[model samples]
Target: MRVLVCDDEPLARDRMRRMLERIPATLCVGEAENGQELLERVPSVYPDIILLDIRMPGMDGLQAASRLSESDSPPAIIFCTAYDEHAIAAFKVNAVDYLLKPVRQEDLEKALSKAGRVNKAQMLAVRRETGVAQPEQANAKEREYISVRSRKGIDLIAVADVRYFLADQKYVTVRHSQGETLLDETLKELETEFGDRFLRVHRNALVALSYIEALEHKGNQFYLRIQGVEERLAVSRRHASSVKKLLQSL
Candidate 1:
C-alpha cells in the first residue's frame, strides 16, 4: 500500500518513514512539511492513505481533510496528533483513526488495515455493487460521533446513542447509552452543530428529537419523557411551544 506522511517537522516525517519501512507490503510514497505541501504532492504520489498531523504552520490537517473530502475520490486519513481534544474534529473529517504522537507500530498496522478495507468499500461503491457507507457521509450530523476524554484515553460516543445534553454551571453532561460524560464544549456550540438532531427544550438542556417519547404538562410545568430513562427533564415555558410543535411534526 502507498502512504504519504504530512507533518510540519522534518524529524517527525523521518520517524514516520522509518516506521513505514518496518511494516511489510507498505511503501512511503512521499512526505510533506505542511498541509499546503501535502496538497501539492498528492496529485503526483496518489497515496492510498495519509498520516496527517492536526496542527501545522499553514492550512492545518483539519482544513486539508475538509478539502480532500470534497474530491471525487479521497485517500483515507489517519490523524496523528499530540492532543486528544481534536479527536472529534478528526472524525468529523472522516478520519480512519486517531493515533496520538509517539505512535505504536501495532496501532499503525491496525489503522492501515481498517483503511485498506475502507478503500475496498469505496471501490465497490464506485461500481454500484455495494451499499457500504463512505467516510464523506460523516459530514452529516447523523454519522457524527462525540469524543470525550476518559481514563482509557479518548472514547467516541455515537451521536445516535446520545439521549440529551444537560448543562450545569460550567460543565455540560452528555447522557448517552453508555451513561454520562462531561464534554468540554458549551451548550450553545452543541446546539449550533447539531440543531437538526437535538432540540432545545430549556436554557440548560438539549434533548435528542429521536429520544423524545412524549411531552407532558403537570401543575403548569412542562416535562419531557425521554426513552430509556426514568428522569424527566423540565422544559422551560420559553421553549415549550416550539418543542411541542417539533414533537407534532415528528
Candidate 2:
C-alpha cells in the first residue's frame, strides 16, 4: 500500500517511517511535515493509507483528517499520537485505529490488519466524516459523486452539484444544483462526511462552500445566502465566530 506519514517533528516522522518499513514491504510514497503538505500530496499520490500525527504546525491532525475525509477516494486514516485523550474523539470521527506514540510494531500491524478488512465504501464513509483534504481546485478532477435517494429511486448527485445540506430531525436535507433530496443521516454525520464541500452554518445545518454567496447580519442574528436558493439560512449565534473566520479566509 502507498502511505503518507504526517508529523511535524522530524524524529517522530523518521521513527514512524522506520516502524512502517518493519511492518510490511509497503511503498513510502512520501512524507508530510504538516497537514497542508498532506493535502497537497494526497490527490497526486492517492495513497492507500495515511499515518497521521495529532499535533503539527499549521493544521493539526484532527483538523487535517476532517478535511481529507471528504475526498472521493480518501485513504484509510490511523491516528499516531502521543496522547490518549483523543482516542474517543478519533473513533467518533470514524478513524480505523488510534495508535499512541511511541508507535509500536504490534499496534501498527493491528491497525493495518483492521484496515485490510474494511471495504472501499467504508473507507469513503470515514473520509466523509473527516471532511475534504483541501478546497476544490478549479482544475483538479472531480473524484466521487453522491447518490441521493429520491422518489424516483436513487438520484446520482455530483459532489460539485450540491449547494448545501440541512438537518431535519434524523435525516439530512440535501440541496443540489437542480433540487433537494432527503437522506437518512444527521447533520453532524454529513458534516463529517462532506466537510470539505460544506460548512456548518448552525448547529443543525451545513452549507456547501461553493454555494455560499454571502453572510448578512440583521440585529443580533446572522444569515447565510446561497446562490440559487431564495431562502436564507439562519446562522446560530454560538457558531458566529467560526462562521466569520471561514468567510474571512474565503
Best candidate per TM-score, number? 1
In model 1, the clashing pairs are: none
Candidate 1 has an lDDT of 0.79
* Candidate 2 TM-score to native: 0.48
Q: What lDDT does the true structure give each of the candidates?
A: 0.79, 0.71
**How many clashes in each structure?**
0, 12
- Give each model a TM-score: 0.51, 0.48
| Candidate 1 segments whose C-alpha is farther than 4 A from its true place | 127-250
Candidate 1 C-alpha lDDT tens digits along 149-243: 98999999888678999999989999987789999889887876766556678889988755666678999999998766889999998877765
Put down candidate 2 lDDT per residue, 1-250, tens digits, no spaces: 4568999999988888888777542546678999998888776554667889987889888888888766544577899998999998777666889998888888888887776445244443543444423223323333467676767888777766677878777777778767877777676655656655566777788776545656788899998877679988999877776666444322
Instruction: Please report, as a residue range, the 10-residue window in candidate 2 with the lowest summed lDDT.
Output: 132-141
